[model samples]
Target: MNTTISKIHPKEIKKVTLGAGAISINEIIAVSRYDAEVLFSQDYRERVNLSRSVIEKFLDEERVIYGVTTGFGSNVTETISTEDAEVLQKNIIRSHAVSVGEPLEKEVVRAIQFMILVNLGNGFSGVKLATLELLRSLLNHQIIPFAPGEGSVAYLAIEAHMALVLMGEGKAWYNGELIPGNEALEKAGLQPVSLGCKEGLSLINGSTSVTAFASLALYNSIQAAKTADIAGAMSLEALKGTIKAFDPRIHSVKRHEEQAITARNIVKMLERSEIVEKYKDYRVQDALSLRCIPQAHGAVKKVLKDAEFTICNEMNSTSDNPIIIPEDQGDALMVGNFDGTFVGIYADTMAIAMANLAKVSERRLDRLVNYHVSELPNFLVAKPGLNNGYMIPQYTAAGLLNEIRVLVHPATVDNTPTSANQEDVVSFAYFAAKKAYQISKKLEYILGLELMAAVQALDFHQPLKPSPVSQKVYELIRSVVPTVEEDRYFYPDIQFITNLIHEGEILNTVELIIGKLDW
Candidate 1:
């Protein structure tokens, strides 16, 4: 229910022009998170019209066009006259709008709208220019469709729910209030659009939902990855873990760029730390949780990079079926571009990578709170038994990690054929991307708990100051979440620090002091 548009001030609104070139992941983030306004280039308008002209010409000749003249899916053999084309389009939206569960966040719905523009703006999906304009108007006016969060195999159901809002037939959120779609559009000074030919099919087809979820998840995963390094560094310093394991020579010989980058990032964060310098040879080497920071976190970075590449490519590409080949006089070709296999596989891999990242952070959190291994006070509190501080927080991290583990099971591996098995072998990419998105959130909370515990453990070291970067990060967290003196309501503290991670406050604070962490 929290709308990104409410957070945007007039002066801060950014404009992203589509159809001029490939859409970048950052541009999607801009529109989704920052409430950036979207615009279409002149070239995009021409392309859309060209493709639409093809559809209109086919309709005039009464040529057979899937989803336009013929029925959809298993009903492809059923032919419809041109007079019934509009009814077929409207019927598809009505029948396919069957997604159920909690409504998705406004940001996600906004991202879906933006992806629709990118997918259809290339003159492939034969949607009318006016239809695309109506969608743009909805986004600019902050009228978000009330899309259900579940019940999607490869994006049809969710997208169909969203498309209903275009016809003023489903629910929508206008100015933070859920209301009838028609009223929402009326309040925004926009009228409902009339479906024409393939407009309805174009609106709901393709992997827009999967790509949108994956795009947002990729952005958050990258943020969590950076924060993991900072959290690991703080824990290592608190445990008085040796820094020799982070030596550049050791990582350079490993022959992985991300591994070396992570090693260097840790060294940079712990630079000139009295805690690390004084205990440089503490017990020869630290635990694997501390010593393998670079390798573990680096492997996550590699997965994140691959996911970014795949998801970004999906954002720019069209996934429409019976795609209009503009060069061949609008020859419609039935293809499997709508299959979300590429994005689904990468998104599943992203969840697995993030699970491993959280697992190691949970291990480090254990080292921070366990008195026997940490050498600090039990639970990092002065009076251990009476205070019972930071003990249950580790349990919370473990629970979150377990949830992420269960979610990492690839959704792509399980296929359920729909449309009477005529559409067999689905991608299930929507759930895959959705699972990855959920895991990113759990990962943030786990990292947040580790950060909170690390800061508390640092207090035990007293006057031995942490590195400048680590100290700044500690202070940044302390600004919102005060140090725990005894047992208290930890949920508020946990939630506050989690917000810090989600908002990039910790990563930004560290980066400002040490430049950007290596990708």
Candidate 2:
């Protein structure tokens, strides 16, 4: 495949400085998505050097440290001589780099690299300063490692694959070409360094992969959540669904912050709507999908909110085994900080949350196309029988929802022992975060179909226009996809609208009209 890496102007590129404070989710997104440059603060360099000195002191004292003088996992008892310590480190990376599948997207690989910096840069992983410098060089230069998308439990195989690139052993993408790792480094004016006492273990061990996926997924899921509100508002207006359910008084009585905020957002989006005003008191209540949107969408928002805290904490944490503590006199404490339970559970929860968002969106999509309910023409088309306008798009939405449902099964709930049962009770957080990321993409498409159908349903209302916010959203959709007078290839229309949702165009447009939606 032809892959081209675009170069950003130096002045335009944003730089994220580590070691100053905890890395935020926005900074991670900046590096991964926007190619933001990463810099190490002087304090970060000092801390990393201090941590590395601890390992050197341990080796000098001939103290038996885990993964330093002793073998890892099940082979913890196996001792290694000083001369063979470096070999063992390199060997572990080679042995563990066995993940097999399609290569992950560059953004994900970049996120993994950034998380590695965050984890080791905390001065607990005993990683050498040069080691982190190389990793940062790879990110700033856009030399992405070729990490496979599958075959990881917690974070071992994939991280091993990534670690191999630093050793100048595995393949990497550089300047749009998949080249040898060493060559990629060479082209980028850098050289690989030999693994130190615990460098390899520090590189591969930990919850880096799971946390990387969770961070990216959480960021996108937040955007998708905001877009879901816009889509739901448009659907409510199109269905002539009453806005009484969204009154501040009704939501205030419940005392759920997100629920009240969602109710307010829906009301704000539908302000000055001729369609809604004409249909006010048209019926006792609309369908639960339209009427109870605040409750349903707010619940999803709550999950996303909770996930942000968990994921951001994980982002700034050091999830290394046998973390080195200078305060404890360079003592290498063997611990289970690498366990991915917290991140795994949250990632799984985010997946379920996104699936529910799609579920509610599909219901509203049905209301838009099904003539039995939607007052508009069958399937939101001018001539429904002749051209199957939106009949099949709803099917597409259902298919995507089904795929998301299958992925919602928590991977963290299951485990298999490895390392000769020494590393038993594994947290399959890698898959959980991976599936959550996958579900977020599918949810975007589902929401896109809802917006597409909702826009069509609004067109039928004619002189009785939607609210100002909804009209702005409609214009944005119409700019990308024209009204479906007669169905031509519908996939492009769905794709265009999906792009709008994915790029936050719909949310951005709505927010411009009615401030920001509450988290």
Candidate 3:
């Protein structure tokens, strides 16, 4: 009752978290459409025209502006006719759509659209209300634009989004078929939004994609880290780990906040476990993976907390250049792009933390599979030389682990100058963070495979009984993997078992019987 819970509000368009799953983008589209209702409200559009009057006064008086009348980027002082302004903006979006890469996951595409609508509705850019309405109709009617993922690199999902807006060349999955942007627009009974002078600049030149991707990655990372803790506890019991290693006195000296906290959690998870407490006579210390769970998992927790603060702020704030600035001297607003120092640093920091999580996870998988420590028949085999056992699973895990290392290289570290050196250093932070998330999923499946193998090995001891908690895990795996006797292509079984882990079947099943087990 005393605790505070975080919640999302569509009314506060600035800080909204994209909803979960494929239709999340659509959900945010609902909110963005609502905001559109506000922006183009009979009262509000009048306010925009009123806002336009200020710009008009400045224009008639010949003020030196940025994108209002002048050309963008280095071509600042080169002014264009107000009549040609809309054409200039349209050209910018079209020219910048030169993104190359795979199409974004549908949810990401939706987030980009929602963020675009939200930014436009903020009443900064001189976009007509129809611009936002066209996007709303596109979302409402499921007319997805076929945007490339090539440009969602640095700023929040801007590159591909700009591409989709400009040439109107993007694909969207409609009903069950993917279609072209023009067709999608037509099918939705809408025309492509005609951009105003600063409208396209306002749309493409921001960080919504990066923010959305970063936020999703961070959310999943928290769950993965927690899953790691549970996995560590499970592995510890299966291996007969020593409680002494997790003793509060040992952690008290280090006093690292999350480390100590997680060490305590591991202790609590192990309490009353008959295997760990009773099996102490069997082993003096568990392997490094089991003993050092706190350090590895705790590090991820700290990183996640920091990334949360940074990304949440980024999602709520603006990253567009030539940002509107209210000036008293002139009726027009002074606008310019600000530096993205914090987003760059924090996003990269998040990437590194996630990489380390996978690094440690790969090690744990090795402990379970490498024939030496696993104490099984060279690979959790039931027969001596007749079978290969879980050899391929280990190979798959190792291969995936190596891929994580390659992706772990920080995206922020290499800053190539772009926009004629106007954007000298860059973030591409979401690039690293997004890849880190994909790698995390692979590792989860990898670890789940290893857990299956470990459980298979444990079952060879027909007479020995595991602690109540681990017994549930073993039962969960048994329900899927069964006891692999002679050997039949085990990949399908591995997949079946890993899916249980990925989908929380094992964990959820464990929770149901856990209280009864007295573990």
Candidate 4:
């Protein structure tokens, strides 16, 4: 139930994530600073040094710098005296902390904290060691800033995140209370930094906020897909849908790789099942969501894998620009490393595939809950008409599906060239990642509804049990959400399941009872 990832080697991120829920900041600390030396190249060192020179120039002459010596975004070129850069940074943080939606959940906020720390620990941002320590301390203490929800443009997630780091103006949590960053810093015995040369630009230039969305999205999407596969098979049993459609021979000919993989997994999950049958009125086929689980879910799998590769690379790589070149290195030319395009496209890919997966889930949930076709009780209620049963939960699920449809629009498609068009053509990955997360969070509740619904129907199967593996799943849900003999207030139960599912306790239960499955 705790579902903690014990040891995380950076390369084994996927497996670790499947087990632990999210990558913790502790993971960055696992790789010592020595690894940082090997990860950066001579060119990396040269760029960092060159970047340092630019910042040094701004400092030595008190000349106005675009972001550091002035303000940020749409006002980057305004000249500010060097004395004001620190105040500028603080002001930027305070004024830009204008996010609109509900505050991000703590786990989500923690994910953001980890990402920022990882980026800084790579030592590419020219961030002082002390700043990194502040981030680490905040993470370890469970104090998180309340990052607002607006300001996610396609090309970048600026205008908001910058306001906090530079100006120390935004809200942060110290110990547990939300307060201004400076107050939090003071409470935590930390010192804010000077917005030296490229520091402000470095702090707010990238998309860690968006990347946080991507990680949480990708993480939840992974669990949702798994939940879909398991629940799809369970629904197959509850509906008495023919297993022949998932037969190996049917998928073998198409060379549909995922089809084969899915078939194998379903077979594994359904092994020794008391419910599924080889012959049922010799029924020929299953519904598309059920029958096509391999294709739909597998597409998500492949896309998630690609997105993971990009995201992991981005997390480990340096994205700050005007990079410092070490004094010892001379062969490299200064260039831009702040581009988030790879993830921008990948985030779009994640949104598309994640929404599609949710679409598939909606279809299956419909089949499972709508008693007219389910041949089970209406909404899986034992005494229909008197008890509404799962009817309202379906409403909740449908709400999420509709929301995902709205968010499925690609975030990367719209981009405004910035930096006076000097840095034209942006990835807008931040929006892509954030929306991916938003859409995916809504999806958890939807999947929870369907999962609970399917198990409820399975409960009505008289004396039959699902596979041993799935019996555990059914019992797990059944334990929390008792079979609805007559519908009562079931929303709380469904909500509880959704939260537990999001916390990944159910997933860990699966891993504990059965063996871990592949993507």
CA displacement after TM-score superposition, residue 499 of candidate 1 (Å): 1.1
lDDT of 2 by residue, 11-124 (tens): 244998999987777777788888999999999999999999989889888898999999989999999889898999999999999999899999899999999999999998
Q: Quantify how close model 2 is to the true structure by its C-alpha RMSD in Å.
A: 4.3
RMSD of each: 3.6, 4.3, 5.6, 6.0
**What would the TM-scores of all predictions be?**
0.97, 0.96, 0.81, 0.82
- Candidate 2 residue 437 Cα shift, in angstroms, is 0.7
lDDT of 3 at 367: 69
lDDT of 4 by residue, 1-519 (tens): 222223332333321111122334224322221011113334434444454554565466764445555555556567777767666755554454555666766656666555655554454455544444555555554445666656555323343442364246567766668788778767766666655445555555565666666766776777777776777777777788777777788788877576688777777778777778533444677778777888788888878777777776666556654454444531122355666677777888888887888787777788887877788878887777888887787777778888888888887888787757765776777778888878777878878877888888887886876788778888888777787888578778878888867766676666676666555
Give the clashing pairs for model 1: none
lDDT of each: 0.90, 0.89, 0.60, 0.65
Local distance difference test, candidate 1: 0.90
| Model 3 per-residue lDDT tens digits across residues 32-70 | 333322123454455345444455565566566566578
